[model samples]
Target chain A: MTAAPTRLACFGGIYSNYLALEAALADVRRRGVDAVYCLGDLGAFGPHPDRVFPLLADHDVVCVQGNYDDSVGNELDDCQCGYVDPQDNHFAQISYDYTLAHTSAEHRAYLRQLPAEIRLEIDSRRVLLCHGSPRRTNEFVWESTASDHFLERLCREADADVVLATHTGIKWQRQLAEGRQFVNVGVLGRPENDGRRNVWYTLVEFGGDQVQVEFVPVEYDFARLAREMADEGLPAEFQETIRTGWWTTCLEILPVKERRRGAF
Target chain B: MAATLPVIDDPRVPQVELASFDQLWFQVAGTLCNLTCHHCFISCSPKNDSFGFLSLDEVQQRLAESVPLGVNEYYFTGGEPFLNPQMVEILIATLEYGPATVLTNATVLKDEWLQRLADADAASRFSLEFRVSIDGFSPETNDPIRGEGTFARALRGIVKLVEYDFLPIITAARSWPEADEARVVGEFTEMLRREGYRRPRLKILPMLHLGAEVERTHGYRPSERITAEMMKGFDRSQLICDHARIVTDRGVCVCPILIEAPDAVLGQSLAEADRPFGLSHGACYTCYQYGAICSNPSAASGGGHAARPT
Candidate 1:
């Protein structure tokens, strides 16, 4: 058992957005967090998949494997994005094929070696970090869908006082029974479909028995990323999300409340 | 033409125990619907009072009881959930506990009801999902099965839902051949886009060969029964009975699809309903083929789809 730090920076689903990752890493360093972590999904929906690896390695960001990482690392055919709609699947397939083709073999090997989950003690408060939920690597714990009691059960099953996950690309936190907490750290890959041209990361600070969770928004060179995506021959829909904050693809999986908040 | 229930007492039938109470379904409007669709699995009709409406009080009671069990989501169904006058209130109340999804025919929806639901959903942290059933893409194709003028009426209801900012999932049972799936889905998307739904969500469902559907098509064959051998290495979570239970006016049922069967009623409460169910019914075969058919797309898993999301 290693000693846990009081403050940490965490993010997930980079989606190969190296510009955002660079900005986020610099921001994390400026905040003076004791350590940094990433919740897998290091590639997809962006250009230059190889650009993200050195940023993570230089920062010593410990990572947990996401479903996308699992798929790309193993050379799987699709992204395993769990979309049911035909149009959504069509776009996802395009992104997955591009990401898989562009990802370097060395980076693929690194993704394959990443652990599915990481456990640590933050001031004696057990914190479990995983790409999605602790139970399933690809589960979407959307803020509008996950219940307090359900989160409590997940904590109990994982034997953690705090659970941090990403994968839904949205950030939310809920304090559960016995002061336990579950946090979905927003992604750094793209905007959260909120019509804002910025991505987000999460900061967790431990004080005695209290765990504080904060979502930190990061602004980067979006126009450049959009240009890169277009140059890579990615779908216009993917670049549209980077240029504009609204998500153009993968709209069906969103719950109604979350979908209502978006501009479509 | 009523559908006949099959009785199978073979011990070889696979028994699936409750994995977790993730989804709690309410047969809120009971077996009474505004339209008598030809392929309705439960044969719901305007006068089919075989199952009775569940009041807001009953739903509230179940919601309270379901909290401690760690239920993840809630669903409301019936002949048509909106037919129950308190359907909006029930959905609002459910949002307080967990995410709620309602399955409806869309013809009975009113603007006022959607307004209230939209307001409630905005305030709550949980989502309120609507699954609107429209049999086909156009009136010529859909009216004969659902009812005359039902296609146009349902489209109006869907447009209203969109106006209220509800991304209602258009659910349709696959009446056309499988080879035409792409064409049918494409047409449905085009029609919805023309009707002001810029980002239409569609779910194609397999026909459950029971109830009114038995009269239209045929019931499941005897070989469709799931044997104990079939359960080997299978992901049991794909089965609704493995993770869900439905509360009706009478009591808790095993699953939403088998409510008319006498053996489907498990108990009076969620606690008592936490038991294993035999996969012996013919409709169970449809569930076996098409996993999580009654659940919203958000919770469904496995069945000729891409892998789970990243």
Candidate 2:
């Protein structure tokens, strides 16, 4: 086995937010990270779906397929976001249609080939990277809702010492039994609905038996992104979430604790 | 009327193994209910004491036992969960271990109870979700089924829950035809918004033809029972028995829906209840159709195009 890298940067759900991707990659390079990984969802909720591909390609960011990526790549009719509410589904369909129409055939093919999970050894600790939970790609593992035992079972079933996922778009970390950990490396595609116009990624450092997980906030050109979205005639609700951190659409999937934290 | 058919003694009935103990349910209020709705599957009523209230101590014990099983979520249901005096305390205790959802009729909710629960929910890391059962958008359509004046009373309770900043999910069993689902849901949403819920969350449930519903509507046909062939390549995760067990005053039952059935009681503890259950009941067919009907939308088994990664 090769020696485990000291520092690794991971982010999830690009959501066509190429600006944030560019800024986050530059920041990762400046920090001198040994490896960078992305947890799928390269399209949706932003303008210019093609802009995100070059960023990932140039940075050599290994990615695991997300639900959106799986849907768009396979030309699925819906985003497979697992929304039950009619209104949420309506807006999701709008975004999915826009994304599917804009994403190039080349990028779609590339997404089709991406792995569902990436396994690596970080200082002898088994680190598993997935788009959502280890068991399901679209599963929502919210901090307030996911029990410690449930997370531990997921990690144990996947046979990993540390599990990293990001479907809920909110960043959280839980210390599990036997000093293991589970981290949701929040998304760079959108603000975390905390009323801040900044997105986030995670920096994980492993030294000996200890692991350090840090949520690094990335500041990008939100005004430009908003303008671009408006120019593309995307829903005002999507642009609102970009300008203000509060999620206007897709609010139904949020659990009570996470939803209560936002202004929606 | 259709001819009554004999029960099938077929050996081909599929048995679903407990995949994981993800959801643990408690029949907190037992068979006691404030309102005897026409469509109540278990026929829960104020006078129905077939099942008794589960004490806070019993619930706490089960909660402790559920930890090792890696239960994903906790649920409370009954004739009405809030009727139990210790309902708030039980939910508060449950939030310590995991998220808690209570199925309730909005007719009997107390502001003080909501206040305590809201406080507890605010303090805990987990969420406390209230699923308020309201049959219709107006009294004209709902009163005949739920009881006279229940619609207004329940609407008031929902308003109070909103006042507590609890975005309760308004659940209604579909009493209308399947084609009218869109219209019925739209009306329900509009009514809720007018009644002060700016962002209404609604879940429409398929009627379970059992208990009181058997008398109101026709009982399930013998063909409704799940067959062995039906389980082939089927996602058993959609079935509540695959991932959940209910703790009642009697003991741990197979599910919240089948607590009254003679064979539904699995065992005395969570460990003993971790066994396969025969899908013989007609209600099991309903469950098979509507996956994870008892869980919150967030915790529901994704049933559509969203594939679960093996």
Candidate 1: give its CA RMSD in angstroms: 2.3
lDDT of 1 by residue, B146-189 (tens): 99999999999999998988889999998888998999888888
Give the per-residue lDDT digits (tens) of candidate 2, residues B126-227.
Answer: 888989997766798788789999999999989999999999988888888888878878887888889899888778788988788788878888778888
Q: Candidate 2 recovers what fraction of true contacts?
A: 0.55
Cα lDDT computed for each candidate against the true fold:
0.87, 0.87
Off by over 4 Å in 1: B1-3, B302-310
Candidate No. with top DockQ: 2
Which tens-of-lDDT digit does each residue in A160-258 have in candidate 2? 989999988899999999978999999999999999999999999988667899999999999999999999999999999999988998887888878
Query: What's the true lDDT of residue A120 in model 1?
Result: 93
Please write out the lDDT profile of model 1 over residues A220-249, one tens digit for every residue: 999999999999899988999999899998
DockQ (CA atoms), all models = 0.49, 0.62
lDDT of 1 at A98: 89
